[model samples]
Target: MSINGQPEKVENIYLTTLNEILDSIAPQNDLELSLNSILKILAKDLHFQRAFLAIMDPKSEKLKLSITHSPAKIDHVTYSPGKGVVGRVYETGQAVVIPRMSENTDFLNKAFGRSDEELKSLSFICVPIKKGNSKEDHNVLGTISVDSPILPMDNLLEHKQFLEVVAALISNQVSRLQEEMALQAQMLSQGPLLGGQEVPPPANFVATSKSIKQVLRQARQVGPSRATALLRGESGTGKELLAEAIHACSPRRDKPLVKLNCAALPAELVESELFGHQKGAFTGAYQNKRGLFEVANNGTLFLDEIGELSLDAQAKVLRAIQEKEIQRVGSEHPITVDVRLICATHQPLEKLLKEGRFREDLFYRVNVFPIFIPALRERREDILPLAEQFLEIFSKEYDKNIKRISSPAIDLFTQYHWPGNVRELKNCLERAVLICEEEVIRTYHLPPTLQTAESTATDTSLSFGEAVAKFEQELLVDSLKKARGNMLQAARDLRVSYRIVNYKVKKYNIDVKKYTGAKKNK
Candidate 1:
């Protein structure tokens, strides 16, 4: 008989197994160890061939293998959202049941390197692990899946429901683990703490986006070589930061890295600034000087806004790059200088070359290895972490103790378009730090543009259910604040029974102590 149609004995056995699994997850045990243990029990008691958990990567938006009960050597496996059954469950925040893997054409068995023949007769069930009632909330963290060849197909619905309950039980633990990981990362980024003061460590490139990571990997690969690298990105996308990272990781790290902004200087002085000039070369040429080429000899010279260089300056730069020699503006003899060039530009160099504003040959020389840094809007997953880093920095600078960004503020941050990219984000956080009075930054502390955008977005995008949920949450918070977190009083004020209010509080996972000034008696 199918498990669903079996006697009460089978139902009792299932409940007992679930309770045992839940009880085994102790707070003191390692998360992975506890999860694996539970999976083993599930595989044995539930007659499943294999069970596994996959956690969603917030940056890449991919589901990565976390723990599995199978003995097969499956590691380093990842699936993009909507790629496989597990991924589809993660993407849609819904449960999926496959009665027979062979019949389902969409079933991709690549997650564990299993071929179609191996999974032909298996049945699969995948369910999302979420912390909130609303599937649209950011609380859908990951997915848990199980498969078995001998399991009855008629009880697929029963199995799906049971897996969902298991997922809900595990969601709280997963959320706690995620919070701990975030805290540890923040502490590491802040460096060692001595007597309540933060000793800042040397800055490093911070990014979690997969695209930026790929760019950084390419930078590291080319750092050890003498190849000319062209960094192309919009303004405020941190081109200079990538340039510095390259220089620091290069073989000439001990040598000086010279930087000059072509657009910042006058056209008349551009050539002189780059090639230097002899004593009395021009009206204000007071003494003999060394050019940037000589200063950066055996090191890297980062030429910012290379597209802004005049044709005259471009010719001299090309010659220096080609022959490894430069001539002082008024000197006859050419001086040999060895320097690696790193160029950056916000403008499209190809278009500039076509317009005769840039030298095509010079462009080829610099574009040997081009790295494109994605704009902030293109990598929204990095937004919160970057904002937190800035918050730590400006909080220290302003002598404030701001500890965190409120969830609502972070929601607004992820929604708004970052026109100015990372630079604008830093400035925004700095301003919020200066004006914030509490330890948390709220939505009101953000710029007016964010507020306007959020209002417009809510009006047009939020569904009726989502809008109702938002209003309900706000009402609960306000009621709790007024009642000093006394559930009885809050329910009376809202004209609801104490049982209903308590249920709602638990459903939302609201922390009652946050609304009350009272401390725990324990």
Candidate 2:
């Protein structure tokens, strides 16, 4: 029964252990218990010193240790993508086999306190839990790994294949558990509103800026009414967050608040997505489905990126708004819908109308109570508070004790223009939290772009007006240097009038003749 010099007894042990693991997992059984049981069996049968499972958090993009077989109690541990051998396996969607853990530089034993002498004799194997059959899909669900001192280098390939099989067997169960967790979270978010209680705005909606506060006030005022509102703002300015807040404050808070992104769907399916489709309405339509309008009856339907809708789709949307009814595709009867509409877009509807891309009639219907959300850069005062908020979230998420951002890091955050707005700031803070090992986040923890901007700026402590003036002066001097002290050329380079450039040169008190002589000699 033995293929190699290894005894057939060991091969039987592997098969028996795998079959037992498979039998232990049932649909009704607790997911964590089943996973822990499997890990325990692997540790015992394979003589592994340690076995563990780490699941990926889709929101924070961090791997959280879920189950471990070691006797020592290891509290919650998390790893960023590409941080260690386990992270590398998750990131690359490939199994890794390290015959000697000590020789591998990528092996980080920070979570488990294994001594250097112990690590030198240990071997490790990690495989990704993928959702799809094809390697091209590369949709990794999580990772499973085992380490032991008894694993022989010659049998490493066989162990790797065996672990990959185990990962494949458990992938579907892991995916189901993750989906259930997400659904539970969504239901909890809406639970208070459903219980006939007034739910306050989400705590994450941090707005100290006067402009954003005014926007929130306007949203609260318009929430009780049935009028369709338009949310106009730049991308990543938290328009969707405002929409959710409005829905929470509305009288129909108990009802469902369905959201759809117009840009995410195709033109052909837009109509069917907004308005329900009957069976046989199109190819692959095996069953009838309720559209967003029907699902959001007596509630709110927030359409994000509304400008991406086609003209035909726009007509159908306009009809739904004006008539308060939607006819299902391939059906004759028009179903009455009492859904409140809230549309958001980053594009200029006026320009779309002039270009004949958007219908003018539809514009007036949805623009009844227009609320404009200011970008993050427009409200620089709120940057630190938002950063601190994100830092707390990510710190807890990664199981790190990071307390605060350093003063230098805060200065850099304020000086940089957040092109992606609040979303960018949130991501930046998440990254800083991941990279920072200390209790405080420093400037080096931030992205290189923010660091470069901070290095180039002269003084971040200046008031907003003074900072703007300094920036203007620097721009004028740099332009003059490039134009060889010619004010007219500098004006053309800087895209300003010659008179204004001359005034800026005198205002900054620059020596233009030095540059002129250098250019003349060249």
On TM-score, the candidate that comes out on top is: 1
Per-residue error for 21 in candidate 1, Å, reads 69
- lDDT comparing candidate 1 with the true structure: 0.80
Q: How close is candidate 2 to the true structure, as a TM-score?
A: 0.50
Candidate 2 clash pair list: none
- Cα displacement (Å) at residue 222, model 1: 0.5
RMSD of each: 23.6, 24.3
Lowest lDDT sum, 10 consecutive residues, model 1, at: 193-202
**Residue by residue across 1-522, what tens digits does model 1's lDDT show?**
235566556577678779888676744356778888888888877778889988875545677787787855656778788877877888788889998888888787765666667577688898998963456735678888888764566677787888888887787556555544443444445454343432222275677777777777667656766778889999999989889888987889999999999999999998888999999999999999899999999999999999999999999999999899999999999999999999999998867766888875676567766788899989998899899899989989989988777666777898888899999999999989989997678778999987677433456677999878786776676667667789898899889999999998998889998778742210
| Model 2 C-alpha RMSD to native | 24.3
Off by over 4 Å in 2: 1-202, 454-522
Worst 10 residues of 2 by lDDT: 191-200
Task: List model 2 lDDT by residue over 1-522, tens digit each.
Answer: 243546667668779889989776754356778888999998887778899888887656788786787754457788788889988898899889998888988888856888888788888899999874547425888899988774666677777888888888887667655654543444344443334423334658987777887787777767766767799999999999999988988889999999999999888898899998999988988889888999999899999999999998899899998788899888888999999999999999878876889886677567666799998989988899899889999999999988766655777898899999999999999999888997778778999989887444556589999978866776676556556788899899779799998887888888888767444211
Candidate 1, after superposition: displacement of residue 4 in Å?
Answer: 73
